[model samples]
Target: MLDSGLYEQLHKALWVQKKLSETVARHWVTTEYQGLTLSSHFQPIFSISHRRPVGYEGLLRASTDSGALIPPPAVLVLPNNSKENLELDRACRQLHLQNFARQETGDCWLFLNLNSQCLVTEQPDAGFMNRLFETTGIHPSRLVIEILESEITDRSYLKQLIKHFRSLGCLIAIDDFGAGHSNFDRIWELEPDIVKIDRSLVQEAGKSSRVERILTGIVSLIHEAGSLVVLEGVETRREALVSIAANADMVQGFYFAKPQQLISSNHEEFVSVIDELLQHQQRQRFKNTHQINENFRKIERLFKRAINHFSVTQNFEESSEILFAEKRSVRCYLLDDAGYQMARNIYSPHYQQTMDVRFTPLLSGDNANWSHKHYHFRAVQHPGQMQLSRPYLSVADSRMCITVSQTVTSSDKQFVFCCDLDWQDN
Candidate 1:
């Protein structure tokens, strides 16, 4: 007979052995999918500030017995069973981590793509992932899980999943952002560490100025929300410049390097390219700033001439007529020292007929106070100098316009002479 203590110890040993064997078997099964050997390719993610490769995203690749490459999308297709999908997901992750371990990555992060379906259907086993990380000698902080923005359905559940991964010291990234079904509401809720702008946006921005403006605004908004932006799929120098202009923190695309089996040791080469791009961007920004300053000077001269004429004639209509004859001023109005309108707005003949009925109430000179307006206060501060307001909605015409105002003292009475200029003209 066996002692109870001895039997208990033997039973515990058997359980540990069984678990280890199962883990190994599971790993072995992932090495091949349907007789095809699975592999991973790395694409470098470059940081604009660093001007070098900061990370590499691991992309899954598969090949057949004869070494024919299979399409990436085909590999993601799984059987109806959720367990099968989970197995494939684990296999891809294992291969990525193994490949990254074997390579000389050198203090850079490894971004791994996570299938949205598997994330929702087969929840991650934290213990298994931790053990795998320990076995591979990869720190959890070095791993970034990239999730497709379009695949997220349950906001609350996704938030919880993000929380779980964050607890494990893994960073979260929203991939293919602005591709389809882009809901900034969910983005705010998830609060991902990184947001990758989609390839389509980058491509379109290269072709259309309007699209570029929108992309720039989106990047600015994302930065304001405390998330780093990665401009993806930059295939040309123009596209990369567009990304730089938009103030993207990172860029990943063919312009840098295509997906490869090994991380290309071309850090110095890329640094040179980024430096040139940075210089070009700086020159362009400087040129734009100079042009804007010139325009401001010209507009100031026009406003000063109009103020001189208004101060002499003390006639809003005649002064506005003279200003509009130059085809720049949209409307002119007068406000007393207390910021109360002194007379009705004198509309430019060119824009007089285009005024919307909704803005009719603004034509009245009663109770309209300009004291709190930036242009009003700024002009008052300078007294005689002209001040230009940033673009704003014009009350008289309900169009985007910039106001140029100057405070003038004519016949012992102080008044603010204001002119509305079309924003498009500026």
Candidate 2:
């Protein structure tokens, strides 16, 4: 309903915008992520673990003649003509193919980045990719396609794409997760192979120390989907430390090592560095153990003193008088070779009843080493005699006691009788 001149103006503006976008796309300004030059944060603290090529992450990058790196464009663009899109696909595929070929030096994994728009292309010229894979002969397992799924644009289409690629033996991942503000519903539906924690969240992780609580919950959520979590953008030691504590399975960030050309011969160097760090960590742990042992010794001494006090008391009736004073009851146990197998009690009608009472071993028999069921007692069976006998339980007063009938002797056959204890009843 606009006037002719106004409509023309608006159309011209849109045309200008489109042309500008195309121009930016044409120049390789390095508009995407840089290459595999990742590093670890532990490098500064414990030295870089630089002996082995742990794994290689596919970094998407483009550069112009000026030698400046250009990050890949964030937005998806399709040219007016199918010819341009097809040509672009071919060139991009070739870049990846070449990159992967150079990267397959050992057991290193090739983590390639895939945009949602690209995978769903109707007829991308995948010939170059197929040829590159064929030349490398790397198992599909070695190639992990990292899908930077910001949000589920098309659920059905995304799932179908995942199935197709998975069938090709490639793994799928959903990246830039938290920043994208994605819903857990989308994650459950897509069921990606990996979910990378956003770098933004990691950067803020330790500034408040609240990172762990948040990251832990996030990791727990991701695991419930039957997929692992890879913490991305680990640029600092603090971040790396916290991430590990948060139970991150794998870490990919500049903290370990920046992405680089094939690790080639430097694999051993990486491993050596790791060994050195492990040794240093071990030394620190040893020191900590010594400190803990010293404290434990102090505690042990105190415990022994308390046990000795309990073992040396000899007046049971007198001690129990303070607790059950009116009852005038006294009980004792033997600590000689005639030990009780298990706990038992004996009943006596009068102080002289023990003179004719029959006593049997409480927990006696074959399994002597494991005789924890009973305790030996050289108890005050009568007013003057401390008799040692079998364990017995007395129904008369709900008490466990033993008759002192047998005696223990030393190696020279001398009677030894010093272990007498009387604990105060509460």
- TM-score leader: 1
- Please, what are the lDDT tens digits per residue for candidate 2 over residues 1-426? 999999999999788766654653453222232232211111111112333443466554545556655444521253445555445544554455455454324655566656555445554334545666787577677667767665337777777767777877777878777785577876898888888778888887756544566787788888988887778888776776666656666677776667643333334444554465456556767985687457335333432332233335533223222222212223222232433322222122232243223433432222332113222333212212323333244322333433223233324331212211111122
- Model 1: number of clashes? 0
For each candidate in turn, give its C-alpha RMSD to the true structure in angstroms. 12.8, 20.7
**Candidate-wise lDDT, in order:** 0.83, 0.50
Sequence-dependent TM-score of model 2:
0.50
User: Against the true structure, whose lDDT is highest?
Assistant: 1
Candidate 1 per-residue lDDT, tens place, 326-381, comes to: 46578888998778988887878877666678777776656688888888889888
Native RMSD of candidate 1 (Å): 12.8
Compared with the true structure, the alpha-carbon lDDT of candidate 1 equals 0.83
User: After best superposition, candidate 2 residue 223: deviation in angstroms?
Assistant: 2.4
Model 2 clash tally, residue pairs: 63
